[model samples]
Target: MSAATIGGQNGAMPELITIDDVRSAAELLRGTAVRTPLLPCLAGDPDRPLWIKPESLQPTGAFKIRGATNALLRLTKQERERGVVTHSSGNHAQALAYAAKVTGVPAVVVVPYGTPQTKIDAARRHGAEIVQCELAVRQETAEAISRERGLPMVPPYDHPHVIAGQGTAGLEIAEDLPEVELVLVPVSGGGLLSGVATAIKALCPAAKVVGVEPELAADAQASYRSGVLDRWSAEQRGRTIADGLRSYLSELTLAHLRARVDDIVTVTEDEITSAVGWLAHNARLVAEPSGAVPLAAYLNRADELPRGRTVVVVSGGNMDAELFAKLV
Candidate 1:
């Protein structure tokens, strides 16, 4: 059943995304973004083995390119002329910068001060002007810049275009693993999780969609459980080593999570670190802590999850060299 069918039972549907939107985004991203590979985990259960979708292979070293490219492609000529601005902790910043550079549109990114240097450098490399701000004020600062410069804001998440673009990852997963039974997606702002869940549910309705988050930054899990939007203080979320999973979800993403996600799970700092190491050593993939959360869930909470062939979305790999060395 489609989200539209489910939304009708609840009330007037909010502007949620659809499968068609995802297909359109896929068309736009055909030559721009990488259609990352899904590799098998040698150590997983033979009968119900795990596969990893390494989105870190994208040019910006993350899956953010898909949504960023789609959002930019949809911009009107007038809007493109005005340029674009948005806030991100890391991956999305680089994604938008790369997308803007390729499309020949100027871009400005407001990023949290403590974001890894590697991500910041990647954004600058793509010709995007960088604006630094405290975690609490990143969005406000981006909005201020947008208003002052008459730049249209392409939000990191919460927009239909962004969500639809991210959903293309799910479309690929379903197409690659038609008989797959479960998917574990790392959740931060919920764009990736929301988009992946929507596409997976629409294409493979029986497949379970699960979200993974760091226990310290578990706002998405809290919001999913309470049936209300919940947020964590920046300081609280910053306590986790998974810097990319700090943001809270918007109402639009929360709505998608509610409608499509089957379960939300939390992993500890140790699990994240171990998963990062495992990805590098066993899977030959360099995964940032945020991207490792889904694998952490698979390893530490397998008993809690449904029995099936599982696919873990390794969302990004943009950690500092020293940090990567220390973790892996």
Candidate 2:
């Protein structure tokens, strides 16, 4: 497909991210984030073998490190001195905190109340000042903190740098499996999905890029099907077990999804739990519910997916110990 076909010719379309942007991000992330391995899934059918990109192996046990590190590194010296702020349910909060600690910058994080204790502890361990609020007001609270402290806001997603950094994962996938026919990515605010889809589409145009989401929190899938940026209420999305996948997609990410994504699928809650258990047992990979959504979609909706070599991105592993034990 041509760029014009995916990215509309109208001037309203936002500046689309290119392969070059992903390359630059890869360069920036070379020494900062781990190059997660692409391991073959021994449990998957031999007829349609599956590969897993376990981003959980990162220092923060999540893919958020890639974007967080890149964004923090790009800050000017003056901006760094002033510090950075962001709002996240968990993973990005820890990522930013860890990045700030390593870069010698103060960091403030606004997190939703009732977030997994493990994630909150991880952020605290990195020395981030934490402010708690309802998920609905988390963004406003973070913005207020940023303005009050004169700190730049490192948004969890939406920014070009974050998307570019996340795209590096796609670049690795493409490089490792040049013949990969299908790529499954779990969607939340769509940064990872947007970046990965953009990179995969550019590097392997013929490969199918599918975004997976929990059926209870399927706002991204709804937006893709409607061609309108559909959003779900915080209460509605909070019904899912996948704590990290509750956020709605931003306009920037919605634009990329509309252009580059082949399809969006929703997996049931049961399937997500099953996937988490399956990965632990068969792949010996610890996956949070949000991270297991792609594998869930693959296992439950195989009839709808393309048959061939497939890759699923296990986005994070930051579940509470109690929850992990109960689920697995």
Candidate 3:
């Protein structure tokens, strides 16, 4: 854990994302990203009803599209002509590729080895040139590609535009369910959680925004509790079933989380798979392991959370066919 705030080395405080930033991103995403519905969970309790925000319904089958499109839309024409580069485990890779295709901007994606082939194929279908590298060096690899190609690097979660774009989902959640008392979001690189927490806290002041993650990759939980940014090695985070939640946080995301998020919780791998199964059977939603984690926390850690109308963000549905078949 590092106690120093991000940008502290230069005596500068990192700017925390605000509700206005999220609203602007929402504007940028109006027609491009899906304004996914907040559907009632059929199996939810009568007293504490649960709603599902299915970002899986997005064009790219994930919430990453919101940020990816926003970032790309904000690019200068010259930048767009030169193209863009990013590193993602899966979801963001597909998102950036799709956004680039639609916007006529060329894209290159550096993916870590062992990423789901389903996601890789999806990105390729959208016309992104794919590069493979070790998980530890994925970011550096993207930077190298950007340097060599003169493409602007649109990071998966570390950038403000990306974070603000992900926050649009939170804006919708707040708008749709202003009375919501608890909002559950999956945390990996902290972009979604940071943005959602910012929007939810601003729009629904009384709502408790909680971040969920696999216990196998609970660096976010540890960091939230300690008020310091904690890091886990790639090998350690890779132990979880939730591949999308394997990445750790950045200084910008950590700052937003510390300021806006109420709590961070962890769930077991079994619980995560169980939640995925439940969503398939009960909610009729095919949530990937990463997307199912918010529901996992709600199902297993309810006693630790507030009681009220709750919303779980089903972040994405991009799963390997074989794995989806077995889980569902």
Candidate 4:
């Protein structure tokens, strides 16, 4: 199938969702997904202190497992046995692989050749088959694989189940820090942000949701302005030190963000560099470009965030050894 539309006229509403969905997801995925910790920022405004949800501690080293696990669990036994497929460059590939294996099914991941070897190797170690191809052709590659094996394709951040699954992070944030008035999340496919927006809008309607993206790969901010799909070349994608923010957005992801997200901000590569290094050395965390995104946003808008409580989604920690060393 193609990318699923999110929160459209016929799409689901975030307001109507019940916490039972999260409880049920947790029950089905217990012992599978880890309870990633929410660590505090060391040097930010102490009066309105900041905290980070280290989703990088996930089993696949990213927050993707929540959605992938939820998706596989919701499938029929026949569908599960038939296997699943998806297109991802990093976290999603490894997550879907681990989730499928945990659910006793097979999985195939379509990745762009530009994907780092660290990610590919990680996925293989978890028992999934890898299919590499051109970057822009990734969706087509997934379609071909799905057609060949009759497998359902699970996109990185484009399905309702996936969005709700990723949103679980936001639910935990609300529970952990009920006083939080602002939350910042990295923007790539928009599933995590949409899920967080949905949950926060319901549980903490007074809170604001902001998305942080690399200036080199700021398609979400651009698309949110024009209200349409935005394309990016590797150059147009940004030469940011954050390799993970190098792709453009899907139509489905853009639509959901347009519906609920409050603001989109772009941070420079230099800013990302500092944030990544800061997170590693000062925060005692390992963060990739996507992972360091929220910190970049906060640094840019340090004056605007509420003066009391702020939460940032420390999305993933899939950094290469050399990359990590050079970044810090």
- TM-score of each model, in listed order: 0.93, 0.93, 0.94, 0.90
Q: Tell me how far the alpha carbon of residue 168 in candidate 1 is from the true structure, in angstroms, after superposition.
A: 0.7
> What is candidate 3's lDDT per residue for 60-97, written digit by digit as tens?
88999998888888888898888999988678888999
Winner of 2 and 3 under TM-score = 3
Steric collisions counted per model: 0, 0, 0, 2
- TM-score (C-alpha) between model 3 and the true structure: 0.94
Candidate 4 deviant stretches above 4 angstroms = 1-23, 304-306
- Measured with C-alpha atoms, the lDDT of residue 202 in candidate 1 is 94
lDDT of each: 0.89, 0.88, 0.89, 0.79
Clashing pairs in 1: none
* TM-score winner, 2 or 4: 2
Model 1 TM: 0.93
Instruction: Name the 10 consecutive residues with the lowest summed lDDT in model 3.
Output: 1-10
| Pairs clashing within candidate 3 | none
lDDT of 2 by residue, 1-328 (tens): 0121222335366776888988988987877699998999989878779999999998898899888887887788888888989998678888899988987889998988988776788888999988999977998998898778887888878787888889999999999999999999999999999999989999999999999999999999999988778899878998999988998887778899999999999999999999999999988999999999999988889898998999999999988789899988
Deviation in Å, model 3, residue 9 alpha carbon: 5.6
Candidates 1 and 2 compared by lDDT, better number: 1
